[model samples]
Target: MSQSPAPARRRRGNARGEQTRSVLLAAAVRAFADRGFHGTSTRDIALAADMSPAVMYAHYATKEDLLFELSLDGHRSVQVLLDAEVGRHASNTDRLRAAASCFGQWHAEFHTQARVVQYELNALTAEHLAEVTVLRRAIQGLFGDLIRAGVDEGVFQVADAEMTAMSLTSLGIDVARWYRPTGAWTPEQIGHHHGRLALRAVGVAD
Candidate 1:
C-alpha cells in the first residue's frame, strides 16, 4: 500500500504557492549554507527571495519550519538517488559502489543544500528531527543491506556491516563540507573515486 505524505509535505496548495515555496527553499539553501541555519533568520531568507516577511510567513511558518522542509526534502533525495543507483546492479559490491558514487556526486552537485541537511540537524525541532531520521535511516539501511549481502557471500570482510555502512555514508556527506566547483576534482570524478574507495573499504581486492 502507498503511504501518505507527512505534514511537511502538505504546504504548497497551488501552482503559485508551489512556485513561491520553491523560491523560498532555494534562497534558504544558499543562506543556510553560507551563514548556517542558526546564523540565518527568516528575514535573511525573505530578503534573499525578494519577498516580505508576510509573504514568506505565508509560505513557511518560521525559520525552523523552512529548515525542516529543506531537511525533509534533502533526506528523502539521498534515499531516492542511492536506491536508484544501487538498483541498477545485481552484485552486492556493485550496488554499494553505485550507491557510494551517486551519493558523492549528489553531495558535490548539491553541496549547499546538502551542507545544511548534514551539518544543521541541531537547529531542527525535536519533532522535525524525528521526521527526518526516518528517511536518513532508510538511506543508511540501503547501503548497510548491500554490505551485509556481500559479507554473506564472502565478498566483503567488514566486521560490522552497519558500522561500515555508516563510514561509507559519511564519506559522501563530508564531501559537501569542503568541495568547491572550481576545485581540481569534478563531482563525477569525486563520485567515481568514492565508489572505488567504498569497494576497497569492504575488502574488494584488485
Candidate 2:
C-alpha cells in the first residue's frame, strides 16, 4: 500500500517554527543588548519576539546559549570582514582604512548585535569566553599588524603600535553605541568619517 500524504498542518507548523526562531533571535539580540545577560529573561525575549516563553525555549535551551551564539556570530562576522579587507588591498594604509570602514559600517548596521556581543561578553562561561577571546584577539591582531606595516612603510606614525590598534578598534566599536540610522549621517558616511579620523590618529595626513 502507498504511504499517506504528509499532513498540511505539519508543514505549516515547521514554517511557523522557523519564523518564531528568527524572531526570537532578533529579539534576544535587542533585549540582551539593552539588558545584561543576567538581567534578561525568557519572558522578556519572548514578549519582544511576540512569542510565548515556551516558543522561545523551544528554539534556545537557555539564556547563556543565546548569548554564546550571538557572541560567536558577531566575532565571526568581524573576522570575515577584516580578513576580506586585508586580502583585498595591498597597501597597509588602504587595508587599515578598509578594515576600519568595514567595522564601522557593520556596527552602524547591526548596532544591537554589536552592543550585545561587546557588552554582554562577560556573561559567558569561562570556556566560552575564552573561545570568544581568541577570535577577538585575532581580529585585533589583524589591525595591529596593519598599523605596524604603516609605521614600517613610514606612511603612518604612532607612539605605540599596539595602543594605536586598540584606539582604532575602539573608535569603530563605539559607533554601535551612539550611531542612529535616522540621524544625519548614513553608515557609509559614518564609516568614511571615522576611517579618515583613524588615519589621522596614526599621523596620516588628510
Candidate 3:
C-alpha cells in the first residue's frame, strides 16, 4: 500500500533532518564562541555553515533556540563523560582524580565549544537557562559524590566535601576561558595538573 512507504520515507527524512541539525549546531557553537551569542545572528550561522538562512530557520525558530541546543548538548556531553569515567574506577581517589582530569581535558579539547556553552548561557531564555542548570547540577553532583566517598573511605580529608568539589570543578571550568592550544601546557598536561590539584583540594596527600 502507499501508506506503508510513508513510514519509511518519514524515517529517511528524519535522518536527513537530524544531519542538517547537527551541522547547524556545530556552526552555531563556533559563531557564538567567536562573536558571543549577543553578536551572532541567524544569517551569520547560515553563512558559517554554508547553508541558507532559511535552512537554519527550518531547523530552529530563532538564534536563541540554536544557542540553547548547543548549551544543552554540551552540558549533556560533560555529564556523559563523567558518568563513563566514574563507572570505570573502583577507589574513590582514582575516580575523583579521573573525573577532574576528564573534565579538564574535555574543556581544553573543546575550548571553543566550551567557551560558548559555559559563557553564553546568559543569553539563553530564563526557561532555557533553568533547563540547562539541571545538567550543570548533575555535573557538580558527580564531583561532590566522589569527594564524599573519598572522605568516607578515609582516602581524603576535606572539611566540606561540597565546597571542595566546587573548587576542584572550577579548575577545569576556568580553563575554557583561558586555554589556548599554543599555550605552555597541552590539554593532557593541564588535565594531569588539575586532577592532582583536585585530589589535593580534597586533602589527598602524596
Say which candidate scores most in TM-score: 1
lDDT of 3: 0.82
Mind sharing the TM-score for model 2? 0.85
Order the candidates by TM-score, highest first: 1, 3, 2
Q: Count the backbone clashes (under 3 Å) in each candidate.
A: 0, 0, 0
Ranking by lDDT: 1, 3, 2
The residue pairs that clash in candidate 2, if any, are none
| Local accuracy of candidate 3 as per-residue lDDT tens digits, 61-94 | 9999887777877788788778887789888888
Give each model a TM-score: 0.94, 0.85, 0.91
Q: Clash pairs of candidate 3?
A: none
Model 2 lDDT, full chain set: 0.80
* Global lDDT scores for all candidate models: 0.86, 0.80, 0.82
Pairs clashing within candidate 1: none
Candidate 1 stretches greater than 4 Å from native: 1-12
Q: Model 2, residue 200: displacement in angstroms?
A: 1.1
lDDT of 1 by residue, 1-206 (tens): 01111224756388898889888988998999889888898999999999998999987789998889888888777776676678789988888888889888888888888899899999989998998888888888888988999999999998999999999999899999999999999989999999999999999962
